[model samples]
Target: MEHHIYIIPISTEKLEMTEDNHSMTNEFILIGFTDHPDMKTLLFVVFFGIYLVTMVGNLGLVALIYMERRLQTPMYIFLGNLALMDSCCSSAITPKMLQNFFSEDRRISLYECMAQFYFLCLAETTDCFLLAAMAYDRYVAICRPLQYHTLMSKTLCIQMTTGAYIAGHLHSIVQVGLLLRLTFCRSHQINHFFCDVLPLYRLSCVDPYINELMILILSGFVQIFSVTVVLISYFYILFTIFTMKSKEGRGKGLSTCASHFLSVSIFYGSLLFMYIRPNSFNEDDKDIPVAIFYTLVIPLLNPFIYSLRNKEVINVIKKL
Candidate 1:
């Protein structure tokens, strides 16, 4: 009995030490796009060009709206903010991804990972609200033209913008806080290009039931609420446009909403696929491709989508 007691205590101490060692992991290796030498160079050049263009385009749009007095209405205000968030979303993922292309180590520290996800989440969440706001603005303009200025006032625009950021920050803080509770002691290698929440959950030694639940609950609520606002607003705008007596008026309203809805459909479609799903864990292969769309491609496309179809912005560019 005495010998057995000593053996059991010794085993317990060893087990504790092992757990300590596992929990002390401070960094992770990001297994990015490709390992082939030639492919790396090709991908690096392609993505570098993308990153440069994304920055220039988004920042240029923001600058244009800020400098132009004509573009001072609610529509442009929301558009400018959307461009800024797109830049942020690209910056959160692309730079590190580019570096990892040539880096042999491809290592990202745990805290660094947390920061990446926080900014990404903030930009994405803010974008959802911003799109919804833009939809409402369009509805007011097209559906209720007489009270457009009164309904979409400057004060209300600023308030909605502020509210979006507040919600984004709150969501990000809660997500990062939940991440801190997890001890990632299994595999140090993350499967995706960047340290996304889902991939990190797959690495956790602890069961991430609560983390997954929170992601579904929080992300679902944000997306659903924002999407609901957008849908309701657009429904009214559509009805108003069809009821217009003049053909020119109907065409003008359709043209205005077309560009906005195009951007919305692409952005929301990719996001809905990424987050609002039950089997995100098993869909590892699909994650990288879908993430590339929202994180890189959407930002690049938005500038062109909004600008090419906008006569006011085009005239402003021509004047400049």
Candidate 2:
């Protein structure tokens, strides 16, 4: 327990103590993972397993991309970066969250909480932009075969990736910077699992009308613009897939884009659920699962979808 702070407890013992004394609620209590009396250990084990799998899968993807010379193509170049982002994002949130599963004190300082949310949002946004860029690569490859090399040249690939990092950081900073402007005199308890902007704002005593508008506008532009571009590229790719003269050519094209399609679905689907709608549209049962899906499940699934599903990648991994 944190010094001078009475934390919300996980057990009946703590619950009883709280009931007897009523000396809690000074710090944030995360009502996540599970609330069952007997299921605590089981929940911990399950999440610890998922965390291990996520780490190994993302780390393995990064390692393979780095070690394999033949796998250093434009597509795999973006894949490697995405893998790194997934690993970093998961590490930033999940390990601490897993610890919170057992620890009584989940109280985070306003600054520390905002920092956590900032990096998590930054990495997530970076991955989104990177996926969009990779989709554009596939669009060029399938939709313009002859120009694929020139369109997605080594120099162009680096520029796209660098642009993703910059755009993601810029997009993330608006919210984080705005969050820094608020003074937290009212309460310190965050509602959701981590220190997400939405949950934090709900607890703020000050009117976050400006901050809310900024979040919506900035989030809308980056998410909607990126997703729209990717969808448009895939739309053309799909049209070309149906019209391809060679069955092999069509199959190859679909194979190349399939992993990305799955990843985008997993990411954008979860994100839209979490962020696209206003809080009026969100309920606890609905939002909590979506939050966990985006923050936890997607990272574990991204590398597998990208690496094992691609023939060239699988061959590279098998050889390694």
Candidate 3:
């Protein structure tokens, strides 16, 4: 009697186990600045403070927008949504990240990771759409002031906000769904603070070509299309502002856009740097700072950026 032996590849074994959801690693150790143990306390304090302020600032703006009858316009509605999404973005990341700073066991379960990434994705994606919507609002207000009210109707504003959320939901769902197909077997240690998709790809035993391609296509399209809208709208706005006979009109136009543009530039710049590149996987050092900027700092800054420069928000605050 002759016996034949067949050996399965280790990668294949890992993939099979992962598919069953009982892989060797059901939890990932988030190696977030753990190397810098001396700085942990300071970092935690700083981030905690930032997180508290971010929540207060963003939610306060939302509340103010809701309460103020004069702020029932299209611009404030978009600003309110932006503030809400910022709060979501900060809340999704900062708590877990802060927890990890002191946690002896910084392991996060698969589902927790998914939830974190989902909310973060949703917030960021919706933010892109919201910014674009705000740009279009500015364009209509500045370029075609005569038709502003007619063009940016309440129904249209609601539809645009609804569309942004719907797109965000779909994008997050698809991305998380794709993550399920990946088999993380190489190492269970996530290099960054959270369960970011790119870091997970680095640990996958299977080729993540499809996942990467989808990110490039979907995220690329979202960023590019939204950015195009912003740029074109701003171009038209600039043309109109410069062509205006009244210095007051030009000043008003620039004032109205300054805050939104600053916010958009910082938000999109960080995003573009983080995701829209081929060698992103190799950029660990650069990634952390950029991620912090977008996920934490941007949210912290946005409320102040929009509010301090605006006459209406200041008046509302004074009345409060």
Give the candidate number with the greatest lDDT.
3
User: What stretches of model 1 exceed 4 Å from their correct place?
Assistant: 1-24, 35-37
Q: What would the per-residue lDDT of candidate 1 be over residues 1-320, giving only the tens digit for each residue? A: 35553443458889999886665587888986764567988888998999999999999999999999999889999999999999999999998999898778788888999999999999999999999999999999998889998998999999999999999999999999999999988889998899899899989999999998899999999999999999999999999999999999999999999999999999999998988766986678788889999999999999999999999999999999
**Over the full model, what C-alpha lDDT does candidate 3 score relative to the true structure?**
0.93
lDDT of 2 by residue, 194-228 (tens): 77777766666678888888877887788898899
Q: Point out the higher-scoring one by lDDT: 1 or 3.
A: 3
Off by over 4 Å in 3: 1-24
* True-vs-predicted CA distance for residue 23, candidate 3, Å: 6.1
* Structural similarity to truth (TM-score) of each candidate: 0.92, 0.87, 0.93
Superposition TM-score, candidate 2 onto the true structure: 0.87
- Which regions in candidate 2 have their CA more than 4 angstroms from the true location? 1-34, 280-285
Model 2: worst 10 consecutive residues (lDDT sum): 20-29
Q: Which is the winner by TM-score between candidate 1 and candidate 2?
A: 1
Model 1 vs. true fold: TM: 0.92
Query: What clash count goes with each model?
Result: 0, 0, 0
- lDDT for position 157 in model 1: 100
